[model samples]
Target: MNNAIKDKVIEILSSIKSGVDFANEDQIVTGGILDSIDITEFITALEEEFDIEIGMEYMENENFDSVDAICEMVEELQEA
Candidate 1:
């Protein structure tokens, strides 16, 4: 399930920009893989894909920093 989420996340990231190795690049926001526009698009994609709402409380750098972190957040949300 985690791998599936990661794969989906990678797919979404690729939609924003191609040829970027998201598997290795953990610092997605810091590394500038996702800019403001991309993050906006990412948020929409995430909400739709995960069927969860990312409230303001979950909007943090730690949550969006890496694919693993995002997957963990999605899992946590699902569990809740």
Candidate 2:
């Protein structure tokens, strides 16, 4: 996995929600760390930070589950 992308995603997630260790690639959604509002803000933050548009097809639980998945998705989108 790309460390740079993962780190940035962790940073974004941490900034959105405090007191949660985002370094373990934790399942934010399943763990109840990210609520509906947090998820919405998170989507905006990620789009702004990465400078990429997340299409509706890319909006899925698995894609937003962990930092690693998010990074992978970013990389894939970048490559595309």
C-alpha lDDT values of all predictions: 0.86, 0.85
Q: Highest TM-score: which candidate?
A: 1
Please write out the lDDT profile of model 2 over residues 1-80, one tens digit for every residue: 88888888898898988788877855788777898799889989988988888899998888888887888899998888
Q: What clash pairs does model 1 have?
A: none
Over 4 Å off, model 2: none
Candidate 2 structure, TM-score to reference = 0.90
- Candidate 1 to native Cα RMSD, angstroms: 1.2
- Against the true structure, whose lDDT is highest? 1
Model 1, span 1-80: residue lDDT tens: 57888899889988888998887888988877788788889999999999988889987877887888888998988888
Displacement of the residue 52 alpha carbon in candidate 1, Å? 0.5
